[model samples]
Target: MAEVRDGYKITELGEIPLEWDVVQQGDISVFYNGRAYKQTEFKNSGTPIIRIQNLTGIKEPVYSDLILEEQKYANPGDLLYAWSATFGPYIWNGPRSIFHYHIWRIEINEKILDKLFYYYRLDFVSRELQGKKNGFSFVHITKSLMESHKIALPPLKEQQKIAEILSSVDTQIEQTEQLIEKTKELKKGLMQQLLTKGIGHTEFKQSELGEIPVTWGVASFEELGVFFKGKGIAKKDLSELGEPCILYGQLYTTYKEVIKEIVYRTDIKVKNPVIGYANDLLIPSSGETAIDIATSAALMVDCVLIGGDINLFRPNQSIDSRFVSFQLNSTRKEDLAKLAQGSSVYHLYAPSLSGFKILIAPLEEQQKIASILSTVDAEIASYEQEKAKYEELKKGLMQQLLTGKIRVKVDA
Candidate 1:
């Protein structure tokens, strides 16, 4: 960790390191707020327009459905940052295009620092800017504020070296993530084949749940276990402490039903809050669109599942919860589509879910299948956890290296 020195003059931030120089963002780069292009002016034929909606901090840029005239655009190398609710600075690699006013384009002058180096610098300082925002309504970054923001800079060679080191780490993380994704795709293909056609068996029979072995039987979801909807807990009742709760937003796209975020209720007033025990199956009853939510259904293990939007199915001893969860997730496409009621949003009722049928194999077979799938799931989870740790490390390094607090030597 770098030590803070007292000699530097007072500015927006208290003090700085003596060796580092303080300069406003504008002094380093040309800053411009994105221009607003009229909706009618947008056409499908021209260049894609970057929007706040398309700006994910780490992911590749997604082109918006709307496009604008080529003249109103940011160049390929310019850095883009969102001014809206979710804020982070990222390098623009997509085609040159216009963007909504909610974004800002930062074009760095080559004499000051490497553009790639500053891209990471802006990313590091963005956290401070976000913390200063007043409220959630319209958290934005003003061009004036950005221009006045101070940063430490090093020699040009050092800037390139630091950016290269951090960029290498990023590349490794990205490759690991890609590998993890490929593993998941492989598992999905394996599950589709294994669950449908048993190992070493070529024949399958037509059943209500779809094609299956002749030995398998069609069973109702109710027959597998007890089903109940989650109890309602008002937002006002939530707390930072006390009993932990899961929200619909915490669900992940992967098969692992890991809860990434939680809300707590100190009052503990709600009764039968649909608390789940290990080996319970949880399914989302409603979502923005039918089948839009990934892992909308998942198996619970060693975690208390709490959410009004989720439905809990406690399977009896005859059924393995993991196997049931896998079957539900795999077969839910058609069922969820049928239960979808609204035009804009799709929802499923508990009654409708309870009426859905499932295929029941012998208890021993269920356990065997569950065990096989669980092994694959465990591997996938390990990869995900590794990726998360790498991402956190990358973020921390970006905060330090990008600001020139830690300097690197460049060969040039």
Candidate 2:
């Protein structure tokens, strides 16, 4: 059972326990900011340099950039936190590395508290630091603010036990993520086999889409459905709550997934509006030169009614929407490149997409292919949900154990 005690309390984060002491972050740990190093001084190879961008986790640091001899350095086991753009503290787990000026290095006295325990405590208070900002703009965390931030601390032994328990949960999460990736790769291989060649003992013949079965025919997208472009809804008209809308600009890199909760436009005209019914397909007609064009197309799984910045394709009963969606997504890179236009901002126009050719099996075969792929999609979704649950469980454990509300036994 957890009993709550109070002094000056934190909002939404709850009250401190009677046995725990509430102290400034500076009292618990030492904080030092890194020095700025010139970009010209950065070398191709010397040592892995940590930067604000590289600060990801307290135990796991992702090193994407390198630095040369002329940079300030921090060693492994030191906690690094970003103070600009995004504010969250992370421990350095990489090899001997240097950091940019925007990052702060935290050194602790082990006799006072376990370093890992302080890491978890910092994680809990990260949101509080972020909440003090004025708006979406960059808010720099002052050294005084960092030092004055309060936290609940327990005895040193209990702190070590708490860190170990939380670390174990993180390990399990990482393993599960790897398993999910392997499963996805297996499904992709299966799709290539079944989709390219018909099931066992099937006849094949020459067609416009290559040597496909006699039952399969080549068809144009315009022949099967009405293709239209979405309206341009301005950013100012967006609202927190409104009808769900799909924006071509917001299409994901996977092209198969739909990202919701983007800026929504309520004042935009709703007529036709590129509203997608179940099984309807949508494609992007334009994009920047740097982006992959194929990733801008998608098929609607659920009924969504809103229109903004997407090219909608409503399939008739003659063809299966899922089949067309898969074919569009699987289009060869060279074919998409051929259709791409405009040097400044590359675009695959609606007319070009309508004219593009696709290989189509019989209606029954198309449905069967879609059914098989849908099962794989469901499995992927299940894994993602499980991953989310594990994350939430880990967060709860961190809150409890780090504060000594729940204690774990440590091996001596």
Models 1 onward score TM values of 0.78, 0.75
The numbered model that scores best in TM-score is: 1
Query: What is the lDDT for 375 in model 1?
Result: 78
Model 2 — which ten-residue stretch has the worst lDDT?
A: 254-263
RMSD of each: 4.8, 5.5
The global Cα lDDT (0 to 1) of model 2 is 0.67
Clashing pairs in 2: 58-91
Model 2, residue 305: C-alpha shift (Å): 3.1
Q: Write the per-residue lDDT of candidate 1 for residues 1-412, one digit (tens) a residue.
A: 4445444434344344444567888888876677776667666556566887666633334344454454347777778878777677877677777777888777778986888888778777776655654622355656777787787776677777878888888887898888888888877886786666655665678976688876677888777778777766655656777776655544544234333333344456666567767666777766787665424444454445366777777778787776666765675455656666666766667687777776777777777877787777778888888889888888878766665445555575
Candidate 1 residue spans exceeding 4 A from truth: 1-19, 57-71, 133-137, 229-278, 284-310, 340-347, 402-412
lDDT of 2 at 256: 64
Report how far residue 368 has shifted in candidate 2, in Å.
2.8
